[model samples]
Target: MAITDEFLPVPVPESLSATYLVPTARGSGAKPAEAVAALGERLSDPVGDLALQMIDSPLMTVDTRPVSQFPELPPDLLAAFGATPGQLEQLRTANELVVVQAGYRPGWPPVHEWSARAVAAAIAQSLDGDLIDVFSLQFLDPATALRSLPDNDGRLRLVDWILVPYSPTDTGLWFTTKGLRRFGLLELQAQEVPAQFTRAWGAIMTGAARRLLRIWTESLTEQDVPAFVQLPIETTVTGHDIAVAYGSPERHDSAGSAGLRLDLDPATDPDADSFLTLLPPAGQAAAPAEYFAQICTRLFGSGQPEIRYTRPSDAMARAVETARRSLRSARDRFLIGGLPPGVQLVVKYGLATDEGQEFVWASVTSWSNPGRIVATSTSDAASDPTVRVGTPVVVETADVVDWALLDGRGVIEGGWTQAVLDERL
Candidate 1:
């Protein structure tokens, strides 16, 4: 689909209209002053020099007032545009212009319709011919983030990034480098009407085009607009809570062994889909599929279980609670198990110190009796690793956050599991 389908165009005002105008210097092939002079006897108002002021980058001020807005214009601007009286009149009512607040100023200064034409001319003059010919421009909302695609070797590459942050404000324009064959230049091909104009405007504002727009605004329009910065917003599914629930043997006896169900909630669980299904805790059952099917019958009974997942922000709070409970009694250790080997963890010191969450990696040094769970900076022999020899609980109810598991090959995967030294021994 065309990028235009993704955004809403600014609504046109009723009192006056704005449209992009091109001068002869920009290759419009018509002169505005000569056109006005040609209508000498027909001229309703005194001929005035056209003045164009920037209301903002990309959108220039135009004076549609039948009476001229400018007392004078630079010889360069006047010399640039040539248009017929009819063409000049058509430019006045064109609906292609976007309204903008004056930069570093308060009120909307009087914009010259003729000046809008001058600005377009200047842009056509400054930009590369290929850029002007190949791309069509339209304004868009600020983009917030970029997602990188992987390279040919399976390594993630920061290629042509796209930001789909779901912002709704109308901010700036984009010139598309794609769809030339299929859609053609958007601005030219769009029907010269308000609806089509708006549609065309919307199509070119993809995140991929924001940088291009910024460059055009700064270089051609002579405006030092602020650069776009991305705000990191965590939208991943990270909430989850784990618990062990037993099923009634008589109720689930037809097709199962020990009917133990592992329930994971959203606020505490990083992996929701698998845990939300209330599967038998990973590694606990001989056959997970059969165990969950039968145990789910007894645990959830016959209806689907309504589970509320927690947001990522809830991590600190949940982790705090688990830490408090674990520190209160040496015998009760918050248990977080089911983590594969080579996982990494970060201990977030809430309200304890100025230091933020500290990242640590987990490596299982031994899988035999009394196996050691080490969380540290690196597994290299030189660096000391923290031996996780804390209290252990029977069920998975420990609060943990800012934690991620890396596979043996060092690729980050998901959550980690905590096993007690006593139980494993």
Candidate 2:
């Protein structure tokens, strides 16, 4: 895509016509001489001098009439014959030209025709350019403004220029122009025509180039397809909860177990062909297993689960021994649970401010039984006393075991049975 495609060009009309009225000379009688003097000042230059001499020669001022007709003059020559609203305003504001009230037919063409010639003469005297390479003059409608039209000469063209006149009252007149084309007018128009024609034509051209560059960049990006891989996993577990009571001879005599149900949806576990159907053919070269391994490594680790079991009686004996040793270590070190992995236990001691200052003691209390474990130093004892007592631990055994021990009040202070925590411990 090109920037040119995004914006349209400005339209130029084939033919245009308008009128202007010449102001009468003031009674002070210095108007003509002053105009001639201003012309002389500019005539010091060769082109301006030639234009002035032509204007002053007898052939030029033939009728000095307020209205006259001239035939088929080149458009550029119009600048030499008349002044635009911009030029007149400059002169008027600067006091170089005076405005005198004049009468005209509401739709008279002759008045405008004569005014155009006068405008050309003024511009010729003021500008340094040759008369063949300047703008044409025209009257704006509503009869309150003036406009400039550039000639066909590539050298004199003005690009993207528009002038609009604003007058709140009929007594005053104003005019503005889009300015001269420093760059080629047609070249600029070929670019983007500005939303507001009064902007510099060169700026519009730069904007068009930038837009084209962006379009080309985006098109290239869209053509280059991206690649991806797919790996799927589907798993489910179902089970019913049951309550198991201990201290029952029969229950204690047999291993405990639970019931579970499972249903795996086939749609969720589609094979390679089904998976490939959703991906681009270009991405199918890799083996499904290779993609699956990648997905596993990305999601879960490469390590496989290891399962082992000891006889129920032996497992129970081992657990009791481990708990007893842990309790003894806690008393000997005044530290809790052999500093269980990732568990931070901090103890700070200071002298008591009052009577019981001789003794320093610490203890690990369990919720399963408020007194399940206790350790303390008695004043007369040579060492701390330690005790390990058991209470019913709420053990949830399934694919995993979640064990929680609570006090009579049913509040859990702390407990850990997660597989990760067990491994560390």
Displacement of residue 312 (Cα, Å) in model 1 is 24
Cα lDDT of candidate 1 equals 0.24
Q: Which ranges of candidate 2 are over 4 A from the true structure?
A: 1-21, 25-34, 38-44, 56-63, 66-425
Off-target runs (Cα >4 Å) in candidate 1 are 1-12, 15-425
Best by TM-score, which number?
2
Whole-model lDDT values for every prediction: 0.24, 0.24
| Candidate 1 lDDT tens digits, 1-425 | 12242221211112222344222212333333343334333212211222222432434342222213323223332222222344343334333322111112111222332233233333323321110110112211111000111212322111122211111111111112332111111111111111101222222123113322222223223233222211111111100100101112233223322222212122345542111112233455333323322333333242111111222344435544554444323211113334332132222111111343232222222222222222221211111222111111111113222233333233353222221111233
Candidate RMSDs in Å, in order, are 25.4, 37.1
Q: How close is candidate 2 to the true structure, as a TM-score?
A: 0.19
Q: Evaluate residue 86 in candidate 1 and report its C-alpha lDDT on the 0 to 100 scale.
A: 43
Give the C-alpha miss distance for residue 174 in model 1, angstroms: 23
Write the residue-wise lDDT of candidate 2 on 233-287 in tens digits.
1111111001111112232212222111111112354531110111111333433
- Can you give the lDDT of residue 142 in candidate 2? 15
